[model samples]
Target: MKNALIIALGIITGAIVIGGQSFYHLLTSQNIVNVASGEVRLGEVYDEQLTTTVTIIGDDNETPILTITDATDQIVKDVKQELAQMVVDANKTLSAHEKMRLETAYFDTNVNIELSTEVEYHSQYQKDMQLTIDETELSHHASEQYHFAEAVDMLNTYASKMDTIYHQNDSFIHKT
Candidate 1:
């Protein structure tokens, strides 16, 4: 009877240790995005992963912060790619002089908007953290939520302007 009790306690302790380790790893670990190869396409891939990480971290509030940060970085790169592409496409339609002017305008606009959105995102994140600190001190989830929201809003705003910008480019095309 004594031996059986000892074995049972050992088994329970072992299970707990294993379970704790698995939980710890899940909370702290994340999939790395490898953009160095120049193979990863932007948009859906980053969005899906970000969504999953956000959901996981929000559920447990223990997920790694790097995942969100990396995703945000990638989204910024994607936005830059988009703005660059706009310049490339406009070059095909407008004269060299017109292209220069329009591209410069787009570039300045992109820079301003990107900087402004990032500032707003950080502000929202800090606000969220302050609110959480008054309660549970959990911040990663809040940061992810605000960052994701800001990114989507920024993207949508950029997309909406694309039509108008392209129309202006078309007008220049017809003029020349």
Candidate 2:
């Protein structure tokens, strides 16, 4: 009877361990699915926003500005490619901790992309505003010059912030 009791307990413990492992795997698989879906949605939103912004900016007939836009698009594509690689890496990993780390990384990269887009938009807006100020025959020439200077200052500040973010992101990617 004593031997039987010990054997029963061993069977029960084995079953419990197997069950727990299966449940963990199920959860992790579901998490990957969710992350993949979220990535798709993010990409869709980003593409739409990029198209709209480019359309608005491209309305201007400045060749240099068009070149800048093309460069900006390339930068955005590079960032997105980095993010796609992260997703692929995450999918290949079976470790829960690794997956969580990748998820955090994915979120951080998205934030960086959004910030870069915003900075670009602000810089473009400032430039457009400055151009308008230049073209207009304002009676208050001094005030117009002051506003133009302010716009340039704001653009410079945005450019500086973007540079900082780019460096930080580069270091972060290297660390990971």
Candidate 3:
């Protein structure tokens, strides 16, 4: 029957979704993925190709340099995993939909940090220490900008449940 087939599809789709979630949790239970990439673009308007280079003069000391590059460093995976678990434990009281939507939204934000820097060291210093960033670097913090909008719907109705879920005073409460 048409109705029977529709029901079967729904059930199959739901099972697939749950299984996919379980698999994702299993893989990410201990760690999550963070990748580094560049953010470089040539303007859409152009008449011809262009490449420009400028030279700078400096003493044996502090100086500023301008360069175009795309590189990334990572934060520790365990720290990120712990944060994810904390967030999950924090919001477990939410319905499955609420929990997933919020987590997805949050994870999207905390990963990439981009900006610009001008470094100068008159004396010897570690390369990492010389790093600097300008306001333009953080062009996107999607998770922060949205700020738990997905879970807003459930807060009033499920506050008590959420409180109970996030209560980490005892390990048993969040064990499974």
In terms of lDDT, the best-performing candidate is: 1
Identify the superior model by lDDT, candidate 2 or candidate 3. 3
Over 4-41, each residue of candidate 1 has an lDDT whose tens digit, in order, gives 99999999999999999988766433322223353221
Residue pairs in candidate 2 whose N, alpha carbon or C atoms collide under 3 angstroms: none
Report the C-alpha displacement of residue 126, candidate 3, in angstroms.
8.9
User: What residue runs in model 2 are displaced by over 4 Å at the alpha carbon?
Assistant: 32-176
Write candidate 3's Cα lDDT for 1-176 as tens digits: 99999999999999999999988766543211121343212212112111111111122213422222222111122223444554677577777667653345442433222223222212212112221222222222444543333323222223333233223221111235
Q: Which ten residues in a row have the lowest lDDT in candidate 2?
A: 129-138
- lDDT of every predicted structure (CA atoms): 0.34, 0.32, 0.34
On residues 1-176, what C-alpha lDDT tens digit does candidate 2 reach at each position?
99999999999999999999988765543211022224211111111112101211111223311112323234444333444464666557656555533223422110101122322111211221100000111122222322222322333444444445443431112223
For candidate 3, give the lDDT of residue 27.
50
- Residue 26, candidate 2: Cα error in Å is 0.7
| Per-model TM values vs. the true structure | 0.24, 0.28, 0.22
Location of the lowest summed lDDT over 10 successive residues in candidate 1 = 127-136
Q: List the residue pairs that clash in candidate 1.
A: none
